[model samples]
Target: MTQLDTAPARLSPAEPSVAEPPAASAVARLTTASPLGRIVVEGDGSAITRLEIERAGALSTDGLPDAPDDLTRRAVDQLGEYFSGSRHDIDVPVRLTGTPFQRAIWEGLRAIPFGATRSYGELGRDTGRATAGRAVGGAVGANPVPLIVPCHRVLASDQRITGYSAGDGVPTKVWLLDHEGIAHR
Candidate 1:
């Protein structure tokens, strides 16, 4: 199993208001090559905010910092370890911004053990929305941090690859699943 920070997955209603808004200069970014493809990671100094896998076109890093901040550098290193198969889980602080339902689904995704797969219905049920498989899938696709959050671990009820939004789509998912030794069609 991948180790994860024990921070509460759900953000309290007052939490957002408690912290001051980050300045424009607070955003930090880095792009690196991985086994899947080129990846762009953005952070707000303290926590990761976004991670994107480049597909046909390179993901824009406009206006972001030319050098990675300490956090981003660490994330990149962890990603390298993951790709090399030395790290099963990435333990980084992530600030996920999304609807309550989406956050719930993301947390559920994180709970899936390394090399294990979960159906969309199973994920929905785990997130307390058992009948919202479609909604669960939507939230999964919207996940900004794919590998770190392990969205590739989700599959259809029949344990078949449904689709993937990051990198080369289903092929990217296949690579990740195969790396983790997951069984899927």
Candidate 2:
């Protein structure tokens, strides 16, 4: 399998995170159809902040802007390429907002290679929190960018599908893992 893109640069605590950008900053959103479903991407004109997959639900603009900025457009294009099997990674800048440990776990998810997977325990260990499997699971579930961050690459210790928070949940994750040819029960 081709090497995947690593996680984008993380903002320091001192910097404004995506979840809480400057009050005057505009939040841009773009929704595009994909094989998985309708994917919604939101950014602050500079970097992506959130991505949501729609399945069995209506797409909502929620009064946000629809103009796709350079960064958001690039992210959507990369996602299209990935689903088409021409791209193995998405190399776009992302602004992640979360606790330090959650950010660490998200970074660890990015380290997992394409067509590969790591157990919750293994990922926790890799992130220097060997005894924090449950915490790691929470962090993974809270991942905002999902596929861009490769949160689907994590699994239970026995290689069983646990759960997914995006799209159709476990089925979505199963589809993603199968797309990458990662084995799961």
Candidate 3:
């Protein structure tokens, strides 16, 4: 029999604490209930940095002011309209944080017109990498902002559903696509 060794790791004194992010990266967050569940929006006064659907937990916004800025308010309102099927587009500015390829993929995703979906191969071709469908899929999967970037509009080559990173996964994706009147294979 082999014996396993376990020991606690020690942190260097110069290292920053991992419990909280740096002051410059500190974000104010707000939570709103949607048809899908709670949506957490994080940003400062300028742009929305992150938007995530919470399936298991909620971010507390107890003492925080309700949408302290116009951008946040617009985001919440647009999301509301989107869920209600009254709005088909979102106009709020998003502060995209990712690599150049990821940003390009996100731009391509945004270009997928409402109620329409494109295959991963088609999206790759549109991004000027016709032979890089797998690479395109990787970037698509890395999308941090889902609904805003519209990554769900990208599908498999057979026009079938694929992976989704938010709100109940593929089922939520189906609901969103259905809400937009998109028919998939």
> Highest lDDT, which number?
1
lDDT of 2 at 177: 95
TM-score of 3: 0.78
Q: Extract clashing residue pairs from model 1.
A: none
lDDT of 3: 0.69
Identify the leading candidate in terms of TM-score.
1
Candidate 1, poorest ten consecutive residues by summed lDDT: 9-18
lDDT by residue (1-185, candidate 3, tens digit) is 11111111111112111222224555656678898888877765555767888655543444566544566667788889989889777766566656656666676777777898888888777768899977888888777667877888888887799787777788888888888888886
The segments of candidate 1 whose C-alpha lies over 4 angstroms from its true place after superposition are 1-25, 62-65
Off by over 4 Å in 2: 1-24, 60-65
Residues 46-141 of candidate 1 have per-residue lDDT tens digits of 777789998876676744555689988988999999999998888777777777777777888877778998899998887678999789989999
Question: Residue 129 in model 1: shift from native, Å?
Answer: 1.7
Q: List the residue pairs that clash in candidate 3.
A: none
Give the Å error, residue 69, model 1: 0.7
Per-residue lDDT tens digits for candidate 2, residues 150-171, read 8999999889999999898988
lDDT of each: 0.79, 0.79, 0.69
- Model 1, 52: alpha-carbon shift in Å? 0.6
lDDT pick, better of 1 and 3: 1
